[model samples]
Target: LLAAAERGDYAEYGGTSVTWAEMEAYFAQTTGFRRPLPWEPGEAADQIAGNIAWAEMNLDAAFEAARTTGWLDLDQYHQQRRLLIHQQLLRTAAFEMPAISTEEARAHYEAHLEDYALPFQFWMRHIFLSCYETHRVEEGETPTSIAEAIAGDRAAALEIRAMNHRRLVSGWDVPVDEIDERVGPLPAGFRLLVPGGPDRRAEVRARLAEIRESIHSEADFIAAARQFSEVEVRNRGEEIGPLPQRGEEFLPELEEIGRTLPIGEVSDIVETKHGFQLAMVTRRTGDQHRPFEDVRESIVSALRRERRNELMLDWMRGLLQGRGIAVDDVSSAEFAAADASSERVVARLQGEDPITLGELRANWEGLNAAQRARYAERPEEYLLAHLLFERTDVLDEIAEEESSAWMAPLLHIYDLVTVAEPFISHQIAEAAAQITEEDLLAQYGASPERYRQPARVSYDEIALRADPPSASPEEGVPDPTEMLMDQLAESLGSVNSLGAFRRVLAEYAIDLRAVTASPERSSQFRDVPLEAVPIEVRAHLASAEPNTVIGPFANQRLVRALWLISRTDDYLPPFEEMRSRVSLDVQAQRRSTLNTQWRSEALERERFELVRPDPLPAPSEATEP
Candidate 1:
C-alpha cells in the first residue's frame, strides 16, 4: 500500500475526493500545498482506478436514495448535496498526508503549553469507620423487641462497616503505600457523602487512610492485596494505574484527599460517607510546557481536520462552478418566473393543499369518529388529560386567533418579544442570531417551570400471610377475616370514596373487619390477619387519604382493615440551598441559547451565498497563523 501510494497509483485506483473547490483552495491557502485540478493530465484515469471510489460510491448511493424517496423535494435535494460535498472532502483529505515541519510543531506546542499541564494533586485511599448517632424507637416498644429487630438487621450493617475499615482505609496519620485499587481520585465514596453534616467529615476521614497508603512503596501490602482483596478481579493481580487528579472525579472523602495531597507522599485517611480511604502517590509528574515534539501528533491531527474541511468546500465549489445549479435571491425568489407560472407550485409553496369541499368534510368525519372511539374506551378523567396534551397546539392557535383587540396587540407584542427570535430563526436560519439577551431573558422568565422533580412518596408496608385452607370443615367457608377481606376488595374497581368502600365490607360475610390506623402507630396492629379485613381498607391505607374507613374482614376468626393516617409532601430544598445545582442548570440553558442564536445569525446574514461565502476566503483565516 505504501509503495502504491508513493507511485501515485493509489490516487487513480482509490483515494480521497471532494466536490467543494473553495475548501480545497482554503487548504492550499492555509498549508501552501498544491491543489489538484480535475482537468489536469491523468485526472479521469485516476477517477476510474483510484482511491476516491468510496466517495463516488457514496455519492451514487445518495442520489439513488434521493431519487427513490421523492428527491424532487427541495429540502431532500439540498440535504443530499450537502452530504455529497462533505463526503467527497473527507475522502480526499484523509488519504493525503500533510507535510508539516518539526519547527512548526514546536512553535504550536509552545503557544498552547498550558493545555498539557498535570493537575497538582495526589489520589489516595484509606480504611474508614463511621460514627453513627443512635435513635430510639417510639417509647412503647420494649428494649427486647428493639434488640431482636436489631439482631436481624444490625449484623449486616456492622459487617459492611468492618469491611469499610479494612478495605477502604488504613490507620490514621500513617503514610500510604500500595493504595487499594478501589481507592482513587473520584472514588465511589465521594459520590455518596451526606452534604454539610458530621457524617460527611467522618466519611472524609475513612477514605484518607487508603489515600495515604497509595504513595509509598509497600510490597507486603500489595502482595496481600493480590492474595485476598475482595474488589472484583483483584485476585487476578492486575496492575492499577495512578488515580486521575480532578476532585469532582471521585465519589467521596477520597476525592478531597486526592485534590489536596502533596505530590511526593501519602495523604492521611479521608473519611467519605461510604468508607475510608488512604491515598498514596505511586508516581508524580509535574506540569511542564509541552515541546513541539510532544504535541506534534495533536497539531497534525488538527491540521488534517482543517484541511479536510477546506477540501470539502473546494469539492462543492468545483461541482457548482459549471453545473448550472441556480437559486433565486431570498427576497426575489417569491416572484421567480417558474414559481409564478405554475399554479401547482404556488399552491404547494403558499401552504394551500388542493382539496375539494367533500374531501375536507370526509377528513373532519374521520377525525370525529376517532375522537368518539377514544372517549368510549378510556375513563373520563384520563381521557380529559390525554386530550389536554394532544390538543394543546390547536388550543394555543385558537386562543391566539380569538384574542380581543385590546388584548391581541399585547399578546402579539409579548409573543414577538418572546418567540420572535426562535420563530424567525426557525423560518430563516440566520435570523435566530438576532436574538438578544433581553429577548432570551424575557422568554426565560415567561417560560414554564422546567426544573421540577417528580413527586415521590416514601412509606413502609407490612404484608400478612393469607391462607384459604385454615377454615374449619363445619364452617363450609374460609376464615371470616380472609373471606371478608377478599370479598370487600373485589366489590369495586379502584376504590375512590371512604363510604363506598365501607358499604362493600358491610355487604360481605366477614369474621373480622379491616381498619386503617395512623402510620405513626401502625406497629400496634402487626398481628392482624388479612382474611378478616376489607380490600378497600387496604387500598385506602396504601394511598393514605384522610378520613377513610376500611371494612370488617375475617381470616381464621381474625379481622383486618386499613387506614391512611399520615402524609408528607414531596420536599425539595430551596433554590438558595441548592445554588450549585441551580447555577449549573441556568448556565447550561444560557450556553445552549447563545450557541444556537450565534449559528442562526451567522447563517442568516450570509444568505446561502456559500459555506465559505468569501470567494476569497482562506483556510489560514480560521485560526491564528
Candidate 2:
C-alpha cells in the first residue's frame, strides 16, 4: 500500500491530482529526509503513508474550497500554486542524488588527514586534599552567646592557620603555629593562627608539599597518593588517564600542569576549588592521526552527504541555465531605480515569455517584510532566482527519474501546506475582525488589576570597601574601619550634595574602585532599583526622602552611602493608554479560538486511517534474500 501511494495516482479530487511521486517530493522538501522504500517496509513507511494520505485529503478539500470561494479562478492563486509545484519538483530531484563510493571516502580522508588528528593524551596520577569538611550539629545542641563567639573565633583562626600553612610551604621560615609569636605579633584587628588547632586542609596541603619534596620516583608518588589522597581512586594508585588534552574528567588545573610537566616527575602544589593537588604525568602521548580503518564509516557518511549537496547544486544550476535566468546580467542599481509598475523586460526565457520588471515587482511585493529587506540591496538577484524557480518544466524532467521516488511524499506535504495556508490565514483574519473596541474595553475592564504597575524607586549608592585591611596595622596604628568612620563623621556634617560627599571621600584618600574585583562590591551604583537595594540599607532608604543623602551605614562586609533619587507609587494605567495592549491580548485569545475551531472542523471533514505494518521477523528466524 505504501509503494502504491508512492509510485502511482493515489488520490484525486476537484481536477487536482496527488501521485506518490508528488507526495514523496513534498515530504523530502519539508522534512529533509527521504520516505522509506517498499523493500524497507516498517513503522516509518506506515507513518509516512498516513501523513501523505491526510495531506492529499486536505489538498483536495482546499481545491474544493478554492472553487467554492471563487479563488480557483484567481490568477494570483494559480501563480502561487505553480511556484509551489516547481519547488516540490526540485525537492523530488534531490532524492535521485548519487551515493558516495568507498574509494571517494578514502580519497577525502587522505586529503584531510589533519582533520582526523587526535589531541595529546596524558597518563597521570593525582593526589588531592579537599578544603571543606561537613559538620553536623548534635540534635540537642543549642547556640549560646559565648559558644557563638567561640565558633566565630575558631573560623577566623582556621583561616589564619590555612594562610600561614600556605606561607610556610612556599618557603617562609616561620612555623605555622608560631606566626604571631615569631613575626612580632599580628597587627590590630587581625586574628592569630590557632596553636595546634585542627585545620585538616592546611595539614593535608603541608603533607602533600612534603611528599612533593621527598618523591624521587613515580612509585614513591603513587605510594604517597594511595596513603594520603582523599579521592576514592587512590586505591588504584590514584591513576587518572589516558586523559585527553581537555575533557570533563580532566580538571582544568590538572590539564594545564599535565601539558608541560615531564613524565615521571611530580608537579608543584596545584590549587583547585576542591582542594590542593599534586599531579604527576606517568606517561604522555603526542597528537597523532587516527588509523583510517577506525574512522572509515564516518568518512563515508560525510562524503555521501557532501556529494548529494553538490548534485543538488548542479541540478539547480541546470535549471538556471535552461531557463535564460542570468541573474548577473540584470543590474541591481537599474532594477532598484525602475518603477515597480513599469513593464520593462529584464530577461527573455528560451521559448517562454520575457520576465517583466512589473512581474518581478509583483513577486517581490508578495514576499514578507523580512524577505523584502534581505533582498532590498540585490532585488535583481532575488527576482531572477524566483524567476528561475518558476520553471516547473525542468523540475518535472528531474522528478520523472525512478530514483526520486523517496521524495514524492515530502513534495506532497509541502504542496498541502502552501495551498492551505492562505485559506487558513484568511479564516483566522476574518475571525479576528469580529473583535471590536467594545471587546477590547471589556477585556481591559475585566482585568484592570493586571495592568497595575508596581511602585518603584531608583537611587544612587557608594559601596565602601568590603575587604579587610590588606595588611594588619602595626602597633600604635588605629584600625582602618575605625579611622575611616572617624574621618566620615567629621566630614559628613558639611556634606549635603553628592559632589560634596565625593570630595570628602576623596580627601580621605578613598577612590571609587571595585572592592576585591567583584562588581557586587563595586564602589557605586546609579539609578539602581529599590527592589535590588541591599537588605541592610533598605530600612534606611524606606524612611529617607528624595534628594536626601543617608548613611555610612555599616554592614558586616560593606559600608554604604545612598542618595535617594526618586520613587513612584503603584497605580493602574488609564484604559486609553492601555488600549493597544488590550487589543493584542484579545487578538491572541481570538487567534487561539480560531485555530482550535479550524483544526476541529478539518478533523471532522477528513477521515484518516493509520495502517500498521506487519511486525518484522526475529533476527534468528530471518532468512537472507
| Model 1 vs. true fold: TM | 0.27
lDDT score, candidate 1, position 127 = 31
Best by lDDT: 2
Instruction: Name the lDDT of candidate 2.
Output: 0.60
The numbered model that scores best in TM-score is 2
Which stretches in model 2 have alpha-carbon errors above 4 Å?
A: 1-112, 118-287, 290-298, 309-393, 396-412, 461-495, 500-545, 548-562, 601-625
Candidates' TM-scores?
0.27, 0.46
Worst lDDT 10-window in candidate 2: 511-520
Give the alpha carbon lDDT tens digit for every residue of 218-239 in model 1: 5544443343232333222233
